[model samples]
Structures are given as structure tokens and as C-alpha cells.
Target: MEENQELEQELAMEDVLKNYDFKKIHTGEIIKGSVLKVTNDEVIVNINYFSDGIINKDELSFESDVNPFDVVKEGDEISVKIISTDDGEGNVVLSKKQADEASIWDSVDDAKKEGKTVVVKVKSETKGGLIASYKGLRVFIPGSQAAARRIELNTLVGQELEVKLTECDKVKKNIVASRRVIEEAEIEAKKNELWSGLTVGEKREGKVTRLAKFGAFVDIGGVEGLVHVSDLSWKRVNNPEEVVSVGDTVNVFIQSVDREKNRLSLALKDVATNPWTLVESKMKTGDVVEGKVLKFTTFGAFVEVADGVEGLVHLSEISDENIAKPSEVLEIGQTVKVKVLSIDAANHKMSLSIKDAVEKSKEYLQYTDNEEESTLGDLLKDKLSGVKFE
Candidate 1:
């Protein structure tokens, strides 16, 4: 019985000694505890010390305004730093906020060294950067690093973004992050996926992002493709902007692609009717047609009779009277009537004659004294009979 009583007394003394072991604690030491009681402004934690430790609500987190109950509840386990072993009342003064800050700063250092990513929540905007939080530690993200493009700052508030630590100063408490770090990688991955699946002749829907004299750029998800000026429409296009404006949703067909160079040749006209075929179906040789002069060269004038269809009028065919050059009789954008002298629609070629058309009018006038008008066939025969082969 005496041995049993001594064993019980030893066990009780061990338990009592364990409860009053706060003397072993050092200032600024981090220790684990469980919440014993929670109040409006303080959380009573059992650090298994001499007395229950108190953590003020203000020290619950770095945030200026915090509620103790919101952060901890009875029986919840948390790590706290011993701000003081005894506050003169034999009680430990603990700080959960300081512990968290120290731990996060260490993490920030590791992230910078290892090039790791961390999540940040935007809290507000400052003059040159956005005020953000990483596990309650303040971080500054410059405006330029917030995104690949300029973005509205107000919309970013309360938003969470993954970022890379670019600058960290433990003494100054200055930490900087860049959201663009992750964004650039995401953009590249998206582009790679799009390039891998893209095929020639595939039709894609996109929005016109910008226009240049040479082409228009379109965003069809992660990649941008160029629609060259000549491919904007079946008709002649002097400027890409003339055919498609910025922000216009356009349907285009991929004409060709170069994965190595990350380039795409696109055409808006391939899906539409071939204008050359339309010209063939509507016009025949000796048929008079109205056209507008498109350009001039030393030898002839090129005129457009229909969309995407042009015919060349040689110097000899410009008029019966001799002319030094086609410019003497025709100017760009000048509307004139010409006879379709020959057409090879399959090859998209056509020859026009202004002098022959005038001669045909004269033939009608002279022959009209007896008959109405000679058939185009009879007119052709007369013209061919007069030709002398060299």
C-alpha cells in the first residue's frame, strides 16, 4: 500500500510540474498551443506553461482590424511566439501575428531563392503599386508587374493572384511580387497548345486586334494570326483597315502556317465565291463592260470590271489614234467602257479593247441604215478578216 501511494504522489507531481514549465520559455521563442478560451479581444491559450497565455486580438494577425473569435476557437491549435515569458503577473504574453510574420518572411526568402510562386491577395492600390497580402504579410506589386497589359486597379482589389517574389527586404519589411511572371508562362503554354493543334485551311473565328498597312492582326484565343492586305477580301485591298476594323469579329481561313516561325497566313476571301469565276459566268468575248481603271504601267492600263477581276488594255487597244502611253488616255479610278476582247477565265486572265468597242459602235451606226445591229459573231468575223499575220 505504501509503494502504491508513493507512485500516485510521483505521478501527480509530474503532472503539476508539467503545467508550470513556462520558466523554460525564452523571449521571441515560437511555441505551439491550444485555445483554452476565446473572448472579444483575447484568446486564452494553454501553452502547457505555468499559467494560461494571452494573445491580444491585435496580435492575432497583421491585419489592422481582426476579431479573436473569428481567428481562434476553443480547442483550436495554433503556433505563437512568446513575446515575454511573464508579463509580471506570471502569465505569458504571446503573439500569433509575429510568429506568422516571421514564418512568412522565411518563406518569402525561400521563394525568392528557389524561384517559387506564391499566392497574393490584392487589398488596395497605392501610388506606384498595389498593396497585396501573402499570408498576412504585406507585399507590393508594381503596376507594371500586375499584368502583361494595363488593367483597371479597382477591379483587382479583393482578387487573388499567383505571383513571383522579385524583391524582399526583411529589415525594411519591403516585399515585392510580380503577377506577370506566371501570366507570361501561361500565355506561352496556351500558344503552344494552339500551335500544336492548328492546321492549314482550318477556319477560325477571331477578333481584329490591330491593323497595319501590310496586314491585320487577329486574336483567335491564345495566338494571333496575320491577314495580309491581299487576303482581306476578294476585291483589291489597298489597306487592311479598309476591309476590317479593330475589334471586328471576322471569320478567316488559314492559308498556310509556319510553326517554326510562329506565323500564319490567313485569308478572309477563301470562304466566299471566287470573283474570277463570277466574271467568267457574266461576261463573254466582244461583250462591252463598264470598268474602273485600277493602275497603269508602261505597256497598258489594268481595269477592274468586277470584284477581284481585272483586265489589261494594251497600248494598241487603248484607241485608234496613236498614244505614247496608256496614261495619256486613262487615269486611276477613271470609269470607262471597254470590249472584252478575250478571256481565259480558268487562268484568271482577260484582255480589254477601248478602240474596238468604239469601232463596234461605229459599225452599228453605219449598218443601222438597213438592219438593226449585226450579231457579235459577224462583227468578230469582220475584225478578224482585216487582221494581217506577220
Candidate 2:
């Protein structure tokens, strides 16, 4: 009975030994553990070994003044490298910083292979480039790759930037990055989207950027469109400056878009407020209106009867006597009284007769002479009734 009892006890001890891990823990081996305790200067971790691991304040991070409690709390799982299998007190010595440095190079290599971007904090501006920190590693960004536009390098210090790694040499421990690559790609994407979504007759608000003799270039979003001088306003525009100046904010419509040729045309005149809409209500046939001669063509003269509205005086209607051309009897800017013979507002056209106007004036003069006892105002009012004058 004594022998059987001793054999049972030995079997139980073998089972207890089997439950514990007998794997040897060595220095330089990375392992994972749960934080068992956290103090101001040290962190105690449970690695399932007979003894707990301890990480001193200096091993918590690359920063010189970091506290152990700030980096980890109790029950938090962390990966650390074994600095020694046993310290003087029988606890495993661990370093979180060494483990991070060992794996950071692999992380950077993976990111580069996948064409992924990384976030870096600018530490300082160097002689030919910028020095930035990525997981405690120094990354070099050249001056030409710093930004898409001109910028002061010193201003970037202490700011975090997103960049693409262009070159990585593990042997030399060098990494080159660029922020301009990402910015330029984003700009090109926006330009392409703007071009694809555009349609003719879409209204947009833009700023005039440049003025030329034939047209003005306006920037709407990231794209530029040309506004021809002829399309600037309803009134005659001899120069683009007459309607819009550089740096002026204006509303425009897309007149035409040629994607193949990469040409865009814009119009500044508001079609809703076209002067032709006012022709029918402002004047009628046979009403004598005072107008200024605007321009002369081979057969007729264009006269401005109202703001932005012009009427044509044919050579036959210049005077009672026939003239070879309207310029023979009328000069540009000359004020004249003309009778409206026809109005085609839908077509933006009107016909005027200077001969008929002269006949009306003669009748008014005769009527005034017959009414000698009447006041001059009363005679003029009766003769001018129903006449629309500007």
C-alpha cells in the first residue's frame, strides 16, 4: 500500500511539471506580455514564466524623460525584447524601445512596397533638405519635394506632414520622401473631374485673371475659360476692359466646351436680362425717339435709342432726299430724332425712319403757329402726345 501511494504521488508531480512551460527565455528574444503592474519608473509584465518581466523607464521609449506609467497601464498587452533572462532580483529585463526599432524597418519597407503614405513630423530644416521623424527614424525630404508651391522651410518644423517615400536604402539607412508628389496628384485629379463634369450653359461664379485684346480669362474653380470681348455685355465692347477688369468677380455661363481641344468659352452677359426683352414695352411704331448714332455700316447706321438697345436706320430712311449711305447724312455720336417703323423684339431688331420724323416736326411747327393765343407749353404737349422720347 505504501509503494502504490508513492507511485500515485510521483505521477501527480509529473502532471504539474507538464503544465508549466520549460522553454528557455534568452536575451534579444522578442515576446509578448500583459502588464501586471505599472509604476512611475518601472512596469511589471506577466510573460507566463515563473518570474515577471520588468521594463525600466529608459526602456519604455526613445524619449529621455518618459515615465513608465505614461506608456502602459495594468492589464495592457505589449511586445518587448528580452534584455536579460534574469536580473539580479530574478526578474526578466525587457526593453520596448529595442523591439520597436527592430520592427520599424520592416514596417517602412512594407509601406513602400504597397505604395502607401506615412505621417512624419518635421524636426528641422537641414542644408539641402528637411529632417523629419518617422517612428524615431530620420527621413530626408529634399527642397524640391517639400511642397508644390514656394514655401519657407523653417515654417514646416514641428508640423506633421503626409508624404510618399520615393527612395529607401536600408544599408545606408537613408529614406527620401516628398509631399509635392501627393499634392500634384490631387490637383490633377481635381482638374480632370472639373473637365468631365462640365456641360454647356452651366452658370458659374469666377474671377477675371487676365485681360487680352480679344478676351478675358476667368478662373472658375481650378479651370480657366475665355470670355470673348463680343460676349462680355449686350452693349458694344471694343475692349475686354470695357466690361470686366482683371481681379473682378463676375457671374458667367459656359458657352462652349471642347474637351478634345481643351478649349473652354464663357459668356458674361446675363441672357435673362437681355435688353431685347424691353423693346416692345418701351416703344411703339410711329413714336419719335431721340437717339445717338452708334456706328455706321455700308447700308445703315446703328442708333442707341435706350440703354443697351439700338435701332437700324437704312440709307433710304436717312432723310426725305435719298442718300448713298447713312454716313452721308449722319455722323457717329450725332443726336437725331427717328420714327420707329417696325419692332421685332424676338429677333432683336428694329427699323427707324429719319424722313418720317422730319415730317412730324414740320406738322408740329405749323400747329404751333396756328395756335398763337395758346401757351407754348400747351401747344408742345398736344403735339408730343403718344410720342416716346429718350
Candidate 3:
């Protein structure tokens, strides 16, 4: 009986010592546990410690609508990070998501060093880019770093992508990723494959990707070609949008290709007929042509006399009187009758005059050449004879 009693005392003492030893473990330590009970606000976990640990609903997932039953259930083993000791109510604070995040940071650090690609699912949309989930951790991708080709970040929600870990801060819990590097690498590979057969003056079909003031961007296969606005059409174009818009599939003639600089000069006008080639045969000097007012500057107004044929009506010849601006007398898109005073097909210049035409028509009917010369001399002598210098 005495020996049995001693054995029982030793077993009880061992149990007490085990409980004390469990209590010595601290908060922030990762431990394995089993789900004991689940509630709307918190979940009870049996961590094999002195007391059952309590995991708040917020710690279940970074997602806001997470339900305890969806994440943890009765008798399911999970890993949790201790947040605090028992709150004196026999409840120890623990977190599941935080522990997972800690592990994710470790993996992210390793992946960054190895330059490894990681698969991440976009969790939410942000102003700069998309918020993504990688092993329960929030990762940020800046807008500029999102892709080689621009993408709608909002549409990427719930979409999975392969990204490279570019930056990581375990202290601030900030992780930054880059899809641009991967995208750029792929684009370069595609360009190399396409460039092998591409040469200057080659023809290619491409989609217009972007329109700018100076030019339009064309996606020729995976490479980009620049078709300057001047090269868009044989006719004058004020804006690239007037000739082509985004997503326009167009056939472009490659004018020049610089492989070293990765530059391509494209021309949409080259594929079309040049209007200037027939200008001398179709148009003549002294012809009264109706033209549209294209643009006005301080020097003159450019008028489209014919298709791809433009003439400048100098500010001096626009009206009999000196006008401050052409806009005052002429408006955009207005048709006007102009006499072609001179046409230089070589230089692409046509001198146009509105007042000279009227004057010439009046002189042709009323004045003789001898009579006009005598009268012009008499008027000049009368106007200048009285002017004397001291």
C-alpha cells in the first residue's frame, strides 16, 4: 500500500510539473494546437498548454468576411502564434493569420534571393495597383511595376498571377512584388524571335495600342512600332486620334528598323497613294479652287485645296486690310474661294490670294496696259512731288 501511494504521488507531481512547464512558454511563440470550440467572435484552441488559447475572428484570415466555421472546426489541428498570456480569465490570446504571415515572409526572403517566381492571387483593388495574397500575407505591386503592357488593375481582382518577390520588410510587414520584370523579359524574348526575320521596309500588320500628340503606338507582334502622326496619312492630321484610335488594326509599312536601339519607324501613309504626285497635272496656277480652312497661325492659315494638297493663305493676302488674326476673318472648317497665285510642286508650297483675284478680275475688264501705266506714274508723281527734305 505504501509503495502504491508513492507511485500515485509521483504521477500527480509529474502532471503538475508539466502544467507549470507549459505556462512558461511565452506569447509570440508558434505552437501547434487543436480546435476545441468555435464561436462567432473567437475560437477555442487546445495548445497542450496550461490553458486553452483563444483566437479572435479577425486573426483567422486577412479577409474581412471570414467565418470561424469556414476556417477552423472541432478537432482540426492548426498552428497559431501566441499573442498574450491568459487574460486572467483562463483565455490565452493567439493568432493564426499572423503566424502564417511570419512564415510567408521567410519564404519571400528566400524567393527574393533565389529570384524565384511566386504565384499570388489578387485580393483587392487599390489606387496604385492590386493587393495580392501570398501565403496569407498582403503584397503590393505598384502601378508602374504591374506589367510590361498596361493592364486594368481593378479587373485583376481574384485573378492569379506569377510574380517575383522584389522587396520585403518583415519589420513593417510590407511585401512588394514585380510582374514587370517577368513581362519585360518575355517581351524581349518575343522581340528577339520576331526581329530575326524583320528588316527595314518590311510590311507588318499590327494593332494601334496608344495615340499620342507626336505619334501612334503600334503593336507589331510583341514589339512596338512608332508611326508618327505625320506618317499616319497623306493628308494633314491635327491629332493622331483623327487617323487612328486605340485598338485599331492597321497595315503599316516599316520605314526603318534599328535593332540596336529597338526602334521601329512605321508609316501608314506609305501604303496609301500620295496626293502630291498628281498635283501639277490636276491643279494649275490662276485656278479658283474651293478649299477648307484647316489651321491658322500668326503667319498664315493652311487651307486644304484638294485631297493631300494644301496651300498657305498668308495673313497679308487673306484680306485687303491687315488683320490681327485669321480667326477673326476665317473660322475653322469654313470653305473659301482662293486663287492660286503660284504653285511650286517641288517645294509643296502654293501661294494663295483672295483679294488679288478680285482685283485682277476688275482690272482685266476696265483697264488697258498703256492707260494703267500712265495713270500709275501720274499718281506716284503727285503723291511724292510735294514731299521735300530739309
Candidate 4:
């Protein structure tokens, strides 16, 4: 009788322990867990349930290279979301990433409402734009909203960019961001700052934004200015495209600024680098050079000796004979040889003489004619005239 009572009491205590171990937990439940073991691939956590929960490396963080030990160590308490009650191995599957995503969504929503910007990492590119990850949520930045139109969208891949949330719909699980919004705001602020300190004759480094028949438009610190074709270079420019192209960086001189019309006149070539500054290195006085008649004036004819450099041929110097006007001897677009009489580089002026060049040509021909007639027999006769031969 005593042995039977001992066996019955032992069976009753076993049934009570089994009932206590049965904790009613279902899938998709938020539970508190303690890290039991951590490894490179997975982490084991005890959730005070019948089975311990398994948190894989991918579930611990959205980053691919995350270490499970770095996320959770032994004896650390963490909140996790239940993925499955049984992962076919009788162990519960939990995700720490999914649990943190809920709070990230709330933060994104608040940022949208508060008009704040968020920083996101660009994961990849899609058909129309870029795909970025804000925490674990995917945010779409359209091509038009990705960056300024001048910037290539693909260059932003794998870079962290700050963006403004244009649309945040938590119910639909859709989020749209715009880097252009942030860039445009910064541009406007820079424009205001530039205008406050803008002055005529201010030198600036600018990027060529557009080309037109008359001029090129350049962006100088958020303000645009026009560089007229004539001012593009000292050399003649038929079109602005010949001097500058779109997206070219150049230095510009602000000639004038009209606040009322919002117009700016810019010059690309300044006096410091003008062709006249180096004219003496190319030619000097008394040097004869071939030139083309560019235009005829009442005083003389403007002849081009070099590109962007013209010399004046006075009416008296146009020909050896007297002339009524420069056009009588020289026509526009005619090629003529001229001698440099004087030069004033500081004033960008040069005086040339075509008559002197013609005279010098005659003297050179006469000298060559006399030399061709001389022979070796004439040189021997001249030397023997003062000596007696033995």
C-alpha cells in the first residue's frame, strides 16, 4: 500500500510539470527573448516558451555582412517578432529586423509630416530611378527626383544621399523620396546669398549650362550670367558653341549686372590673357609680314597680321605711288605684304607700311641679280691684276 501511494504522487507531479511547460504562444507574436547562444550564422534565444527561438544572421540586421554575435551576445535581452512557431526543426523562428522596421516606419512618417530630410543608402537602380534603403524599407527616388537634371543618376549608386520624403504611405507600404528637392533648396539659398554680395567686375568660376546663337549661359555660384559670343575670345567667334560647350568649367569676368532686368554681361577672355599682350613676342618693328585686308576705313585699311591682331595701313603707305584713298590700292579681303613701322602694345595699335615692303622687295631682287652674274674667273682676274706671275 505504501509503494502504490509513492508511485501515484510521482505521476501527479509529472503531470503538473507538463501543464506548466505548455505556454500558449502563436506565430506573428511580439515576444521578449534572452540570447542563449550566438554563432556566425544564427543566434539562439530563450523566449520562456516550450522551445528556444532561432534568429538567423539575415534576421538580425538588414545588412548582409552583419555578424550574429555583434547583434546579440549571451544573456542579452531583446525584443523579436515571431516568424514561425516551428521552422520544421521544432525551434521558433524570430526576426529582430522586422521588429525594428515597425518603429522605422513610424519615424519616416513623422519625418514626412515634419518636412524633415532623411539619409538613405542607394542599393541599386531601377528602370525609372534608384532604389534606396531607409533602415529596411525600400524608398523609390524617381529619375526626375533623384538629382539635378545635369547629374547622371547612375553615378549615385552605392552612395549615401540625403533626401526629402515626398510621399509616405504606411498603409500601402510605399515611400517616395527626392534628392532634387534638397538640392533645389540649397540652390535657392545660395542664390540669395550670392545676390546679396554680387558686384560688377566680380570674377567667378562658372560652369557652362547652355549655348545659344548669341551667347553661352554659365552658372556662377547659383546665379546665371550671359557670356556673349564677341566676349568669348579675342579671336572672332561666329557662335558661342565654338568657344564653350555645355558643362564646361570656365573663368568669367562680370562686366555688368542689371538687377532690374536680372541680366548679367560676362566676358570669358580678360585683358590679362588678351592676344595683344603677347604681340611683341610674335613680331617687331621693321619686320615684313603677309596680311589680309580686313576692313577699309577713311584713315587707312585694317589688315590682319595674326588672329585677333590687326594693324593699320595708312593711305600714304598703301602703295609706292600716290593714292586718293586706301580702297584705290587695296580692296577688302585682299592679301598684301606690309612692313611693321611702329607698335604700341599697351594701346593695342600697330602701324604698317605696304610701300616700304614693296621697295624692300625690289632691293632684294637687284642684289640677287648681281650675285648670279659673278663667276670664279672674274674673282681670279681681280686678284692677279695687282700681282706678277713667275
Candidate 5:
């Protein structure tokens, strides 16, 4: 009976040892635990080990100064890394901050691979930029990368902004981000969407944003279409700003669209009521029209008889005498009378003749020696009879 009782006691001791081995936790191992107690400077965690774990205020978080009770309460389950199996005392030393930092770094790596944007809180300032804390990872945002336009860096203080990670280096513990990158990406997407719906001959309304020497840029929605100086008006447009000023809303016609290059050819001229259409009805051939010479070319001089209506007088028709150049007969802004010779409204062309305007009619007086046959002697005798041979 004594031998049997000894074996039973040994077996009971072996079962207890096996259970302890199954629940044993090693140092440097990360595990989850429930908070058993919270104090101002330390939190007691139960890791299912024989001894409970203690996380001091310094190990609670990455913050320089922190209170354990402020973050963790009793019965809160938190993951912690066991720093020491036994620190001379019976309690284990655990670090919740280290575990959190490791987890956040993994997320940052994933974000970098996925090309994702992250929201970070501005925590403090750095030398050349502001430091933001994402989860627990610190990201650096340069002053110039904070906005689409340059602004005061301190303006971002305490403001939460979304940013893309431009550089993420886990080995060097460096993370660089840009707020401008995210904004530009969003704008590009909207611009592409705006371009997709556009087609040739699409009528749209827009606001003039600015004028250039070559063209003007208008904001239709998200895209900016270029209105060249030539397209601003049917008449001559020496300057774009003269026709449309900045911030003016105007109706525009899309002449063509190049989707591959994101280019739109636009027009501001009349589509149905062209200024040239009224030229034939208002003036007829052979009618003398008063006009101002606007410009001179090698072939002729362009004269404006009415608003937006111009007629060309060929070099041969400028004068009855030969001329080497149109400038010899007409200067810019000089007023002259021109006889309309031909009109081609479909092609927006009009021909005029200045020499025809000053020509003599067919009944002009002439001088010749073809009088009647009454001789000078007969006339003399008649005068002698009337005057008594004076």
C-alpha cells in the first residue's frame, strides 16, 4: 500500500510539472496579456506565466513622458514583448512600446509597397520640416512638400493632413512624405476624367483663367482648354487679352480634341451668324465704299469698309499709274474710296478697285481740229463786209 501511494504521488507531481512547461514563456518573446493592475508608472500584465509581467511607464510607449494608467486599465488585453524572464525580482519585464513600434513599421512597409496614402498627425517640428506620427512611425514632411503652393510651414502645425510616402527606409529608420504628391495625384485623376468625356464640337461654358501671348487658358471643369489668339475672334486678334479678360465667363466651341495629348482646339467666333455673311447684302459691285486701309501685303492692301468687313484692293487696281508697292498709294489708317468689284462671301473674300473709282466717264470732253469745212477766207470776207475792210 505504501509503494502504491508513492507512485501515485510521483505521478501527481509529474502532471503538475507538465502543465507548468506548457504555459512557460521565454524572455524576448512577444505575447498577449491582460492588464491585472494599473498604476501611475507601471502596469501589471498577466501572461499566463507563473509570475506576472510589469510594464513601467518608460516602456509603456515611445513618448518621452507618459503615465501607464492613462493608456492601460485593468482587464485590458495588450501585446507586449518580454524583456526579462526574471529581473532579480519575481516579476517579468515587458515592453508594450516595442511591440507597437514593430507592428507600425510593418504597416509602413506594406503601405510603401502598395502605393498607398496615409493620414498622419503632426506631432512636433523638425529642422527643415514637420514630423508626423502615423500610428507610431515618424514621417518627415518637407516645408515645400506641404501644399500645391508654397506656404508657411508652421501653418501645418496641429493640422492633420494626408500624405504619400516618398521614401520609406526601415534600415535607416527614415520615412519621408509629401502632401503635395497626394494633391497632385488627385488632380491628375480628375483631369483625366474630364478629358474622357470631351469630344470635338462639344459646346461648353468656361471661365477665362489667364491670357498668354500665344493663347488663353480656360477652365471648363477640371481641364484647361487653350484658346489661341486666332480663335478669339473672327476679325484680327493682335492680342488675346483684348478680346477676353481674366475671370470672364464665356461660351466656347470645341473645334477639335486630341485625347492622346489632352489638347482641345477651341473657338469663340460665331457658328451660325458669320460676320462675312452680311457683306454681299450691304454692298454691291461698282458701289463706291469709304474705307480705312488696315494692312498692306505684297499682293494688295486690306481695307475695312465696315466693322469686321475687309476688302482687298489688288496692287494693279490701286492706281491708274504703275506702283511698286501698296504703301506708295495708301498708308495704314488712311481713308479712301474703293469701288466694289467682286464679292465671295463663302470664302470671306472681297475684291475692290481704287483706280476705277477715279476714272473719267465715256462722255468726257475732247480737243481735236475736226471742225466744219467753212474756210478762214470765207470767214474773213464775211467779216470784211460787216466791218468795211478794217
Candidate 6:
């Protein structure tokens, strides 16, 4: 009878050992279970262990206004972090959201190290950018990292995007994603592929993708080239929009290439007839020309005599009267008549005057028909010699 009792006691001890496994709790272990009951205070989940686990309402969400029903319901399968074993109640305190966050951070770290693209779903909009979900983990995508072009975060809600993991901090539980980096990498790859056989002075068709103050960005077969405002047209341009608009198809000449910087300088005017080529033949010194006022500086006003050809009218020569500034005498886009005093083709400069030409014309009228013609310089020297100094 004593032997039989000893065998029965051994069997009972084996049953107890099977029931209480004494599982080890590590830092980042994912414990899965089913929600047995949920209430405003806490959620009870059964993990088929010795006892059910309890997750407090506050641990259910990172959001402040969290409702238990929104997160879990009865008989719903769930996962939780084994925060700690129960005291005397024989229950385990768990955190569903925390476990998910820990798992996500691990994945994010791996993605960044391997340069892998992660698929994320847009969850909500924040002031700075969008909040996204990746494998049940919340990640932040700043506004500048959202796209290669500006995009509205509101429009991206509920959309899935392939993003590269830029940063991940397990201690702070912060994860940052960047879709722009992936886009830029793709663009650079495409640019390198397209530039392999390209040569200078090559003519290509492109579409204007962006118009900035200084230049327009054109897309030529997935490669972007910059056409500076000065290269857009022979005529002076105040704004890039005056020459090209976003989405406009245009023919451009490759002016230069910097493979190191991945820069391509494009020109629209190079492909067109050069206005300066015919300027020297059509215009000469002492010629009366009509021009439009283009810009004014402190010292002078620049007049557009022809396309890409501008002559400066000094403030002192704008009128016989004294003027403080060129703007006082000339307004932008106003038409004016002036005489070209001199032209230097090599230097690309033209000196213009209105008062000097009028004086010269008056002196010619005063010369007698039978008298020998006197040069203007000779007359001025003779007149100055006769004046007595005090």
C-alpha cells in the first residue's frame, strides 16, 4: 500500500510541473493570447498558461483618449508583452501596445541596416507630418521625408507606401521613415543610367517638372536637369515662369555636365538663333534706337535695345537736369528713345545717351555750309582756351 501511494504522489508532481511551466520572461518576447474579457479598467487575456493575463486600459494605446472596446473585444486574438508575473493573484500583467512597439523597432533597425524598403500604411495626420503603421508599430514620417515633391498628408491617409527606414531608437521607441530617400536613390540611379552615353551639345526633349525663382527643373527620361533663368531665353526674364511652366514640353540643349555633383546644366536659348550674332550689324554708334526699359539700378537704367542686347543709360545722361536715380526718369517696361554713343561687341557693352546726341546735332546745325567743318573735340578745346580763370 505504501508503494502504491509513492507512485501516485510522483504522478501528481508530474501533473503540477506540466501545468506550471515557469516560463522565462525576456526583454523582447511576443506573447500571444485571446481576449477572454475586457472592461473600462483592464483587459483579461488567456494565454493558456497557469492563469490569465491582465492589461490595464492605459497600456492599450499611446493615445490619450483610448477606449478598451476600440482595441480589443471578447474572443479576439491578441498579443502582449509579458511585463511581470502576478503576485498572489497568479495573473500576468501584460501590455499589448508595448509589445507591438518593441517588435516594430527591431524590424526597423534591421531594415535600416540592410537598406530595405518597408511597406507602411498611413494611420493619422500630425502637425509636422503623417503617422504610419508598419507591422502594428507606429512610425513617424516628417513632412520633408514624405515625397520627392510636396504632398498633403491628409490625402495620404489610408494609403500604403514603400518607405526606407532612416532611424530607429529602441530606448526612445522612436522610428523615422523616409520615402524621399528612396525616391532620390531611384532618381540618381536613373540619372546615372541615362548619362552613360550622353554627350555635350546633345539635344533632347524634356518636360518641366518644377519652376523655381532661379531656374526650372526639367525631367529628361527620369533624369532632372536645371535650366537657369538666364539660359531659358535670350530675352531677360524676371521669373522662370515667364519662360517655362510645370508640365510644359520643351526642347533643350545640354550645356554642361558635372558627373561628380550629378548636375546637368541645360539651355533653351542655345538651340535657338542667337540674337547677338546679328546685333552688331544691325546697330551702330550714333544710331537713334527705341528701346524698352528693363531694369534700374542706383547708378543707371538698363534698356533692352533688342533680344538679349541691353544698353546702360547713366543717370547723369537721362536728362539735362540732375537726377538722383534712374528710376526717377525711367520706369520698368516703359519705352524710350536714345542714341547709341558707342558699342563694344567684344565686351558686350553699349554706352547710350540722349543729351549728348542732342548737343552734337545742334552743333552740326550751327556749322556754316562754306566754312570748314570743325570737329566737336576741336571746338570744345578752342572754347575752353578762350575762358579766363580767376
The whole-model lDDT of each prediction reads 0.88, 0.89, 0.86, 0.88, 0.84, 0.84
Candidate 3 least-lDDT 10 residues:
16-25
lDDT by residue for model 3 over 118-164, one digit each (tens)?
99998888888889988778899888888887788887788898999
Best by TM-score: 1
Tell me the tens digit of each residue's lDDT in model 2 across 1-390.
Answer: 999999999999888667556485778999888999989889999887878899998998877898777788899998899999889999899998888877887888888999999999999999988999999888999999999888999999999999999988777889999999999998779878999998888899999999999999999887899999878988877889778888999999999998888789999998778888988898999899999999999888988898778889888888877677887788889999999999998987899988889899999988977777567779889999999978
TM-scores for every predicted model: 0.83, 0.66, 0.52, 0.57, 0.77, 0.48
The whole-model C-alpha lDDT of candidate 5 against the native structure comes to 0.84
* Clash count (model 5, backbone only): 0
Better of 2 and 5 by lDDT: 2
Which of candidates 1 and 4 is the stronger one according to TM-score? Answer: 1
User: All candidates: CA RMSD in angstroms?
Assistant: 8.0, 8.5, 14.3, 10.0, 8.5, 13.7
> Which residue pairs show backbone clashes in model 4?
none
Runs in model 5 with CA error above 4 Å? 1-24, 63-70, 123-129, 142-154, 205-212, 219-222, 245-251, 270-273, 357-390
In the range 242-349, model 4's lDDT, one tens digit per residue, is 788999999999898877787888999885677887889989999999999988878889898887788999988888687778888778889999999999988879
lDDT of 2 at 133: 90
The number of the candidate with the highest lDDT is 2
Between prediction 3 and prediction 5, the one with superior TM-score is: 5
Order of candidate numbers by TM-score, starting with the best: 1, 5, 2, 4, 3, 6
Candidate 5, clashing residue pairs? none
